[model samples]
Target: MPSILLISDIHGNFPALQAICTQHPPEQFAHICNTGDCTVYAPYPNQTLDWLRTYQAISIRGNTDDKIIRLLKGQTFKKPGKKEKRIMYTSTAESLTSENSAYLLHLKKKQVLKLGSYSLGLFHGSPADHEEFLFDNTPEKRFQEIASTCKYDIIVTGHSHTPYHKIISGIHFINPGSVGRMFDGNPAASYAVLTIDEQARQKIQVQHFRCHYNTEEVVNELSRMKLPEIYGIMFKQGKKLN
Candidate 1:
């Protein structure tokens, strides 16, 4: 059996990602897959990107990444209307260096990977759209339809920042949640591990895990950077502090 790590929505919190990586080193896994939103919302955009590059993790472009790319190209995909979103976008965009921006711009939007005997579809959101969200509470019928339409035996996604594993239409769907900014009332980082049992009939096992990091460090950095105070509040409370 071989194990693969599934991570997503890093949101520029390097400490969180580092903590998760420390617990499950890259050498222990056959492959590492990131579902996107690799940068933004916290400090350390450059460091987070550097970490991902060092690990050679398979990554897909997330909506946040797309926004950064659009900014770099002097374009706008969607205007940030809300105050918090505007601050988040602006702060993250300004923090990224030209080199980091280029790396993000080149990230693929989707990936179909062959992991051992399993064919996996990786995306930031649903297969049909990158901005769409597929959460744990999504309707099974709808998930089944999406599963049937895709060519993969398993679909791995992120963006809702919630972790789940479900079988729909005989296809497995997993979301490893957010590695940086978690919104489920827990400040701990979230991720998943997929184990492929070559000798077993079932063939796959999904395990979700959370790692604790120094949230105060991120919060203090956010404050030091003069990003909106709400960002720090959200990091501390694990929800919108408004």
Candidate 2:
């Protein structure tokens, strides 16, 4: 079967990242497409980068990832609140390691790949804005606007931190949500394994894979390290804490 591993907003939670791999296993995907933000929030920056490197996923730069890279370049970062400060410190401090800094700095912004019969465009936010968040509540008119500028059988976007799929005018738009920082009430570091094919008669079929991870492990790790932003509570509830 032709398959794609769609992930985003890993945010440094290594256990959830591990759980995703353990559940799907690398053997399952034809390709792993990450929509960025792999280096903040949680406590496993290097580990997260290592896993992505293992697959050498087609990654696009996220807004958060951009900020991390900026810090690595010794550029001044915006003053974050207490929670945001924790994220800044972790990402900045952990990334001082040359490997992490260089890796993040060199990540590509976006790409379009052909998967069998489908054209898949990978981007962190909208094609127009890498950080422009299109949420479930985004107006349909905006969706129409996004559809107008991008051409692909499927458009894969992350940043809203929600897993959703909706087909408009024959274009399939998908957000795999946060692979390591889900706010889906159960906090399993949600992601999607999408299997699409033309229906025998003539149409597309989509299957959404929503999996749950061990929230306690994430919470425990957060508490153990005292990571910033009280992110643990949000993940536990499966929604954005900040």
Candidate 3:
């Protein structure tokens, strides 16, 4: 049996990623995949991207990543929403290095990976829409609709910052949650490990892990960068503000 690590919504919190690596190193997994949002909303954007590149994790473009790409290209929506404005104007976007910018630009919107006898569909959000919210409690009809659109044994997604696993129409759907900014009222960093046994008709096992890191250190880094103080509050509270 080999294990795969699924991570998403890094949001540039390097310490959280560091803690995850410390607990679940690359050697323990067959492959490490990221659902994206590698930057924005916290400090250490460059460091986070560097780590992802170094690990060579299979990744896809996230909504935050899309915003960065648009900013790099000097493009904006006709009527920018508050979230769009916040993401485009974040210090993290300003600090992204050219090398990392190129890295983000090359990311695909979705990835389908073949692992042994199983096929996995990976996306930042849903297969049809990258910004859509698909959570644990999403209606069964909605899952069925998504299922009708894609063919895969398992579908993995993120962007809601919530972790969940469910079987809809005999397909396994899992969200690994947020690696950096978690909104589940838990301050710990979150990720998931998936084990597939090729011998047992590709039996799947999913485990979610939460690693505690030094929140004060991250807060101090954000303060030093002179970013929004609300970000610091969000990190401490482990919930989104507004």
Cα RMSD (Å) per model? Answer: 1.4, 2.4, 2.0
**Clashes per candidate (backbone, < 3 Å):** 0, 5, 0
Model 2: number of backbone collisions: 5
Give model 1's TM-score versus the native structure: 0.95
Q: Give candidate 2's whole-model lDDT.
A: 0.77
Arranged by lDDT with the best first, the candidates are 1, 3, 2
Q: What tens digits encode model 3's per-residue C-alpha lDDT throughout 1-242?
A: 87999999988889999999899997788888999898887788899999888888999988888878887787764424775347424566678889898898899999999988889999988988898999888888999999988889899999998898888888899999899999978878999999999677648989988999888888999788666677788888899875
Clashing pairs in 1: none
Query: Per-residue lDDT tens digits of candidate 2, residues 151-188?
Result: 88889899988778888767888888888776667676
Tens-digit lDDT track of model 1 for 1-242: 87899999999999999899789987798889999999878889999998888888999889888888887888875566777677777777877878778888889989999877679999999898888888999889889889778999889999999899998888999999999988989999999999989898978899999999999999999888888888888998888455
Ten contiguous residues minimizing lDDT sum, candidate 2: 199-208
Query: Ten consecutive residues with minimal summed lDDT in candidate 1?
Result: 76-85
lDDT agreement of model 3 with the native: 0.86
As for lDDT, the candidate ahead, 1 or 2, is 1
When 2 and 3 are scored with lDDT, the better candidate is: 3
